[model samples]
Target: MNGAGSAKRPATGEAAASGRAVAATRTGPGGRPGSGKSSEAAEGHGSGPGKSRRFQAVTRDTARPEGGGRAAPGDAPAPARQWPLLAVLGATGLGLLLVAFDAFRVGTLLIGLAMIGGAALRWALPSVGMLAVRSRFTDMFTYGGLGVSIVLLALMAQPKAWLKIPFLDDILHFTVR
Candidate 1:
């Protein structure tokens, strides 16, 4: 006989079915074909303790302005509200006012001491003083003093105004320049 049946056979539906069977068996613990995932992992896709472990997530606020860039890691922390500092300053100011009403020179001395003590305390323990007197207060005090000094100098340069209230002009005209 000629070698009619000796050539390699063409792949038919039977070959396809057999190929699928081989692929099924080659899969991992799950019944799917050639998947590397485990049976437990496949079964735990939607509802299981392993859900969080299966995926990573990232989130950002939707309301950010259009031109805003990514936030820097070194951005400053939010400023804390400092009612305590305001309360302390307000109380001290009221006390000074009352004292001045009763005794002018003594009140002025006490006010000076209080201001110096406040500055010293802030210099000593900045972290604690940050809680007591906010940085804004210190800034306000510094600029306010400079502004008052400038105004007093402007007034003192005018001898006519100084003549109206000699003691008042002397007290107010305490600026170096």
Candidate 2:
């Protein structure tokens, strides 16, 4: 076998199942049982064969989201490219600071709005840098869902709730203790 073939071929003398011998093609590359001789079998990811088996995603690197490109042009400074992410982070940080300083309601409101705003920006912009996680629709859904949830929870926080629905309280009545 050539060098490439040697690399591609799994080492022999390795096969088993709880100390019992198994077939070669069934044992997988590491001689580990149920390790997936084919990538789709082992990893349960639909990336198919070939490249999927070679990727050690847990230990190595994570593939960026489909739209994880620069917010600005390539020639622009790094900060400019990541302005979307920075804006979201800065707002969230400010919200956290306000909360730490004992301004709970306003702080939480700002935090939730910032997330909602981030979602809006992600939707409006083509290149949002780190703000782009997963595909565009997925990112939008995740950010919008979380932001709405946070905002709703903030508005419904104890004492004198602002946006109360009678049925909502009844649905969540298990927390009376």
Candidate 3:
């Protein structure tokens, strides 16, 4: 019986290799092939259940722009020119400044003009870069509405009776009260 048991038992090196083979073939808790937790650890999945896969490092090219080279990974995109938007903004700012100096008529006119121009730009241009604060339709409606309101307010601002809309006073009184 001792001789038979000895014959059946593998040598140390062979037994170690056979043990590794059996471990490799064993399925994990999920019964999926190669899903064993031990294999996951061997494949660089950490020993802890919460451990996530490690990220691989990426190499970037640092070639020149003039030589048809790609931009570096961290490089920021070039700013787009928005002359029309700048013009409108400048006009509106100037209008406010004028109002501060008590040039009410001129200031209101300038502001109204700016709104009208903004509406025109939205209608004509497919893309307004940074100037596009809202959808095209909304922008147009807001600009037009503000422009018309400013013009109407400016016209009625004078003390002259002819400039006043008949129903406006009643509406204003009703809303204000």
* Candidate 2 Cα errors over 4 Å, as ranges: 1-64, 173-177
Cα lDDT, model 2, residue 95: 92
Rank order (by TM-score, best first): 2, 3, 1
Backbone clashes in model 1, listed as residue pairs: none
**All models: lDDT?**
0.40, 0.71, 0.61
Give candidate 3 regions above 4 Å deviation: 1-80, 170-177
Instruction: Give me candidate 3's TM-score against the actual structure.
Output: 0.50
lDDT of 1: 0.40
Ten contiguous residues with the weakest lDDT in model 2? 9-18
TM-score per candidate, chains pooled: 0.26, 0.64, 0.50
Instruction: Please give the lDDT score for candidate 2.
Output: 0.71
Best by TM-score: 2
Candidate 2: tens digits of C-alpha lDDT, residues 21-107: 323344444324433243233434425323333334234357777668898999999999899999998998999999999988778
**Candidate 3 lDDT over residue span 1-177, tens digit each:** 123322443332453466422223234543344232333343445445424354423325543222122212224343325555776899999999999999887788899989989888777776565556676777789998998888778767866633677798899899999
- The sequence of per-residue lDDT tens digits that candidate 1 reaches over residues 49-103 is 2232433223344442221222212243333233334433664586479666874
lDDT of 2 at 109: 85
